[model samples]
Target: MVQQMVQGSVDKMKAELVAYIDKKFEIAALTSDSSGASNTEETEDSDPITLSMIMLQIAAIFEKFGHYDEIYRTYGIEADAFQDECNEVLDLMRYQVEQVESQLKDFQNRLHIEESGGESAVRHNAEMQEKFEILSKDVQESISQFDQYIDTQLKQFEDMPQLLERLQQELASKQGKSESLVRLQEHKSEMIAKIKAAVEELNLQLPKVVSAQIEKALKD
Candidate 1:
């Protein structure tokens, strides 16, 4: 009876974690959709409030996972095996929080750049692409860590690969949009085509890179 109760609690916690993650993704999709609607103006900056909300949700996930870890320990079920995995996941979550905070700060800086006027728009777009690249790298690293952990702990969670692919696609779309915006400042049509092609190639390569990393993680 005690074992059954413990198992029930564990299942409940897992369900809650899954629900929370789903909600996080939902919020992210909503944010992207809202941004797409507003981005038609070309003058509006990315919403800091939306980013802050995502960060807050991430923090909550971290905290909830910590609590779940403690509960797992109390149940005395593979707690030792999970210790390193839990620690690594928490570290990744903390790193992601830092990344989100950095993004928020960068967005504010971009706003200031916008206010400065003139060719700053082109410069701003370039900086935005650079920021996205950094963020993409950070996300790839986090996903790699989690992919490894998932392999060892929950092999049934096949959605991770799809999730990673979706994230990479979103990042690529943002990069492409930024590049196009920057190209608007250039008078040479040839240069714009070349730049767009280069960025598109990079975007095509990025998913493969992320996929390779996840595959390597699973193997290790």
Candidate 2:
């Protein structure tokens, strides 16, 4: 039994080592290929195997190792252990993807906000002050709503067996993670259509404060 246990450990270690090596190789290859391509015409035919390809190869290797029953049997590795390890790895990969997507969404949100406040100048200080107040209030409300949404998501997904805390940190550091804002960004055209339909509702609801200082400066 001891010998079998030792063998199982060795098999698991071997599989993990191969996976790590593959990852490093892929990173190096991708970096080199991208750098080289940036300096040249870079024909499509000359494309290199990217990080994604490396991940595919890693998956294939794991699959092959999984089918090697003799090694598992020799090492006394239980089927449950194999399943647990695979599930953990899969969950980790999914978390990584989620993090990247979150970051992308954040970048989009910031871009959207900046675009919304373009180069047009407010001519009246009073009007500018009022607009600023309204915008600040709206932004704060959006933030509060997003915080509530994240709390809810955390509560809902917390009990998931495969959830990792590190993944949450990565997602948190992402660029535009405000749930409500991100959702609106995703459905922008639809949201814009809705806004157009309810412009009067918005105008009526928001306060009518003005910034004379800002308006006067713009006029000058």
Candidate 1 residue lDDT tens string, 1-220: 3455556656666676567667667655566666655544432433323567656766765676666556656766665556778999999999999999999999999988777785877788898888667666766796776556545444433555674565556656775776645544342454456557656755575577677765654444
> What lDDT score is found at residue 115 in candidate 1?
74
TM-score for each model: 0.20, 0.22
Show where candidate 1 strays beyond 4 Å. 1-77, 118-220
Per-residue lDDT of 129-188 in model 2, one digit per residue for the tens?
887787666556655655565465446445433333434554566676686455544555
Report the poorest 10 consecutive residues by lDDT, candidate 2.
Answer: 205-214
Top lDDT model:
1
TM-score of the candidate numbered 2? 0.22
Cα lDDT, all candidates: 0.63, 0.60
Q: Candidate 1: minimum summed lDDT over ten consecutive residues — where?
A: 40-49
